[model samples]
Target: MATSLPSHPIGVFDSGVGGLTVVRALMDRLPFENIVYFGDTARVPYGVKSTSTIEHFTLQIVDFLQRQNVKMLIIACNTMAAVAAEKVREISPLPVLDVIESGALCAVAESKTGGIGVIGTPTTINSNAYARAIHQMDPDCRVYSQACPLFVPLVEEGWLDHPVTRLTAQEYLKPVFVEQIDTLVLGCTHYPLLKPMLSTMTGNLKLVDSAIAIADQTAELLQQQGLANTQRGMPDYRYFVTDVPLNFRNVGERFLGRNLGAIEQVSLDRL
Candidate 1:
């Protein structure tokens, strides 16, 4: 998002706390940039919701973030990226980025055998968004997909390495493993939190986390736009949510790898 407005905070949002992983990556990659994050905690799990509803909620958050005067927007929820990115781009004033397309591009580059595995929420997997994006980029890539609906809640609940989580991964990944894919795309933002367990399960397989791709692109865009923040001190990190600010405060730190200080509970209707 190259822009004349270099000081505007970068806006990032998801259906819930999972998007914090993207925020965390941005923090690591662009420590001096300001950030404003909104988690739709009142209505979590956008993966199960209908496309129209996802678009509605997404636009509401985008409107709210636009009011904050952000220079860029990142759709960290894979499901929303799959179903709602076009609408988001249509309405957003700033540059918009999504997780699915980035991961697909990365998978195509990282895969050695042209065999790639994708795992995401049922809505995301059922949509076949990753496979399509991969094939569009490289017609020879073989795509294997699985929908792990339980992974979101499991990560939110902080069951990162629990046996139940491992067992669940084992069961869900059985088919993908059979495809002999060399690269696995963690299609959902929430799946990154389960990295340790997933690493053990998909041994010797390269894991493609969309956060890296998104962060790299964000930095590249910032440079291209001459909007890179040049300040050196700690930058502002403010957070807002639709509901349960405290709950997000509790679970969000794990996703963010730091305390989410002074979260504001907002009513989108009021905004």
Candidate 2:
């Protein structure tokens, strides 16, 4: 008898729809691979949660994905990626990818003045995940970080280009602009939706989207491991959420920039 070939899908999770940004990147970057995404919407805004709570939720999602036979895992939320990535790696049998390091590396590689600004949730900023990663790669680099706790709620509420969002972006980024930084890291996954406003506020600064960087890294790793799906056939993508609101389809479609075929609501207990 021949040995069985692994036919598992890629598992991606986040605190909420923010991770759909990562999914969009993966779909564009790795068209052959199938993806399974889980959004913990009932527990949205993981940024304010305790480290222990985030870790526990992360593990539960990873375990659930393992049950679905995921070949690899991507922690798409910045808060969870910053605080619980290591713990998930310890228990996962598959390769685990996180967003913080990839975004940091990209910022370091693209910065010319050695000045980098990072914006994320309170947890991500307070943890200094981006600052630490950038400094480790280049200690001479100046790292400025700010917490934009409102960005998540704004993004979640689907207010990307609202006048209020523009004002909020200006207010939050004023300090970083004063420092004359040339690189800005969208440390939080949700922040990418606000990129247009952020760009307007930051002038000519280079904006780094962690979702894009991580997607690139994911492609390279899969190819290096000889696990890159070689199929040219249509790949299936599944979306699941802990709590599906009436506006989930509308909000998710906007976030993903495409229709989410069908979203199934699952209990957190099931995970």
Candidate 3:
């Protein structure tokens, strides 16, 4: 039998621009695949919402991506990944990948002392998703979780290295530091942008970003399924947001570490 070619773009969605981190990793790891990214900026900060609301929003985004004929879907937000991943998998026709479990697995694999610290949005920490996943992998592993609610806004405001970010990181990570964890997972995609401040505060703890792990897993899954895009030409990437900000292009360029072309705005209600 002749093999079929994979042509549909991979779809990635997040509550805001944070998921661009995952996109950047995907570009480096799977350069031949086209990408379609969606940001729920109009409903930004899914962290503060209830689980049902997050699930509803996630379903909507997944449906929109399905309409776009994406080959796979990536839930790039930790909170959504924690609360709605299975729900999405149940409903989505394409393979669905999430950030939390991938990060938890990486932290568990890297931890020598079985002490892992996770810092994420309020919803993600409160959900105990990382702790549950890590503990399930290794019952003896100790998981410490903290809610750094301000980190998302700080990252959105482009205050990555600001003194305020340092102070905030110190305050948020105090409990985790006291736990003496050997591995720290950046549970929120936005948290990676604040890595310098987090590292300075955590002091010697190994930091793990889910983006790389998710990218690696995505690559493996594609290969196994025989859905890997083998094109040698330059891949195309499209970005769409519920609400386009004035600095969307500039901020996105910094986050993705590359120039983003046109960004289209879409109405969530219509979708």
Candidate 4:
């Protein structure tokens, strides 16, 4: 059996800084737990990649995190979660938590009319993971999915409320609203960065941010597994990246909602 401990840092990875939203939520939800975050900055924008390529990249990150001795794993990237979560679980001895599953659960519980909408990258939407997950939970729930292909780039550019971003959001969400959904799942991790604007644009639609949902689910899972960190002082937080592109710290801190502190760059060859 794996010798997982409550004090072992939880491993979180994303194609890029998007997953930091989940890390931010986890910080707020579980203030005492240690965290180790990895961002594949060099090979980001995995949305355009093929299934086999995405899966290959995801497993490499999982293996690296496993070597870090994480007590648990959180697949914070929607694309990775949709494509490789099952594969990761098969090889990982540690408990795995994914944002897609958490978001689906939250959507089902929040939707009163059983009308749910999901917005994500082309890959996630194409995978039909959110709709399938939602339907599995509640067969009666109607799922409306949209591929907001530009949101990630807009978010990465730090145009959270730019006029162009707002216009794009309006154009992308129009069809979803036509379905009369009461709940909208921000299926992509990066989508949470645009929450304030999304909330304003999507009036009265309950927004299920996967970051927050996953954090809540993580807390519950830790409690159930008796792995909730007991020590309360400042916990360790480490960040690893394949490369530090221009404005990496700035964009990352924006996603994290705080200073990124010191970041260590690791080569992909190391994985």
Instruction: List per-candidate RMSD values in Å.
Output: 1.8, 2.2, 2.3, 1.1
Candidate 4 stretches greater than 4 Å from native: none
TM-score of each: 0.96, 0.95, 0.95, 0.98
Error of 2 at 227 (Å): 0.6
Candidate 1: segments with Cα more than 4 A from true spot: 1-4
Q: Model 3, which residues run further than 4 Å from truth? A: 1-5
Error of 4 at 36 (Å): 0.3
Query: In terms of TM-score, which candidate is strongest?
Result: 4
Candidate 3, 148-207: lDDT as tens digits: 889888998889999998888888877788886899999999878888777777678899
Candidate 1 per-residue lDDT over residues 54-105, each given as its tens digit: 8888888888888888988898889889988889899866888889888998
Residues 15-91, model 4: lDDT tens digits: 99999999999999999999999999999989999999999999999999988989999999999999999999999
lDDT of each: 0.89, 0.87, 0.88, 0.93
Ranking 1 against 4 by TM-score, winner? 4
Better of 2 and 4 by TM-score: 4
Q: Where does candidate 2 have its weakest 10-residue lDDT segment?
A: 1-10
